[model samples]
Target: MENCSCKECVSACLNDPGRLVPDDILKLSQFLGISIDDLKENYLVRVPVTSNGHTAYALAPAKKKGQRYIANPGTVAPDYYAEEKGRCIFIDDRDMCSVHEAKPFECGAYMGCRNTFLGKPYRAKTVEEYFYKRWKSK
Candidate 1:
């Protein structure tokens, strides 16, 4: 999506947050001026991710409820937006990304406002593969 803020795109934020790559985590940590540990404790949650039958825990912005993210992994927050969509913790009440400057790669890659990808739509899968390798090291 480019130069568009359609309802579908806005619904993306209302549905679920995106997965945070390692770099996303670091960026958010610095942007918030907090240690990674504190960020994890307060803003991020570990969720299960699976690819090719292998599963691992990945970090993402927490879900908001009662003024804070449901940061517990064992809690009821949706792990994947495609499967069980929910609200992003960073989305403002006006339906905009509050942390738009430092949003996750997964958020901006696949879904677009006009449902029009800049070049290749499959970049989403490509990015997922890239991150899968990164996470494999953990």
Candidate 2:
């Protein structure tokens, strides 16, 4: 079987690099030869999940003009969901991921227009739990 070069997938991810899971964060840090703490401080942002009051740590989206692509709609009753839009910081001028080997789970699973299986739906709590643990450790 021929290997899938992931050219299409990478193209789609270049447009919208989706949220990162906790494990992705750790892996990304290691791939970038940095500490988890440094990765979080430098490249991650706390996004509120509306389904729960907890905040999930996600890769910081790239900025354009004076606006951030990630938009937090603020806390709403019952759920405090925020929305992330835009390309990942790791995506370079060539429309490729700088940390493709350590790309987040969402990025890895995305199949672009091919519509392949992209894994199970994300559980915000898992990310929130990771955030709390990391927060406590600090």
Candidate 3:
């Protein structure tokens, strides 16, 4: 969230993890020095997102159960579930993000984070719809 320090945004990682846009997948892959497929298989969870009464698939930085991200969160083709949702795997001991340089788009762009990377504030659903389109295109 850049220079922001709001509690809700920071504490969000404690339960709900941030959503990822399509470009974030590639950015995170490059940032971690891993292939796109590796990032998808290991770090991301494919989850269902809904907007306008329709459902689509999208990605999120996986929530962790132990020291690792939960496996098979990407259960099926489009409507997958994380089952036991947990904290963000990238959160450090100090409760700060370790991947700020390539953090998920919603983490940096959403109003909950107090840093509007999209130039202005937007409803969370608006952001979700944007991501939904991007994922559907892929």
Candidate 4:
């Protein structure tokens, strides 16, 4: 927790670091109205099944496609679907999230894009505020 600011960490972790370090999957399970274990099993361990080959970190493989994006053989999921999946942990691109609020578990665990502020690198003050700042452009 070195160099950790209270508000920023709280914002990043999405719970009171005072009460407890929030279990991200647990929080997601609660929000999705599903069992924690089920959520973890279904989302965390399961990789997206993509036919374009693979993105390295994607939970599932990309579905097959007709030739729009050749890097992978399949059609890339639209931004909307990608966003819904959250952090797009399939590759090295951490900056491209189609969804933030409802992103998938892998996206949630992504620490690469944290601490960005107003186009500057800094700790986000809170999750709510961070989303407001990050996604307001869309």
Q: Name the best candidate (by lDDT).
A: 3
Residue 18 of candidate 4: its Cα lDDT? 12
- Location of the lowest summed lDDT over 10 successive residues in candidate 4: 13-22
Clash pairs (backbone) in predicted model 2: 49-80, 50-79, 50-80, 50-81
Candidate with best TM-score? 3
lDDT per residue for candidate 2 within 3-72, as digits (tens), equals 2346676654545445566667678878999887777666665543322454433444332212443432
Please give the ranking of all candidate structures by lDDT, highest first, separated by commas. 3, 1, 2, 4
**Scored by CA lDDT, what does every candidate get?**
0.65, 0.51, 0.70, 0.33
For model 3, residues 1-138, the per-residue Cα lDDT tens digits are 444547866766766777787878888889989898888777677777777887777877777766755544444322333446578867778888878877777776654455454657666678667777877766
Alpha-carbon TM-score of each model against the true structure: 0.72, 0.57, 0.75, 0.25
Per-residue CA lDDT of model 1 for 1-138, tens digit only, reads 334457776676676566777788888778778887888777777666666767666777776655645555334345443465567777777778877777666676545554533346545555556567767666
| Candidate 1 worst ten-residue window by lDDT | 73-82
Deviating ranges (above 4 Å) for candidate 1: 1-4, 65-82, 114-119, 122-130
What is candidate 3's CA lDDT for residue 132?
A: 75
2 against 3, candidate with superior TM-score: 3
lDDT tens readout by residue for model 4, 15-115: 11111112344565676677855554443332222223322222222321232221232233343443232222222233222223444332333243454
Q: Once model 1 is optimally superposed onto the true structure by TM-score, how far is the C-alpha of residue 100 displaced, in angstroms?
A: 1.2
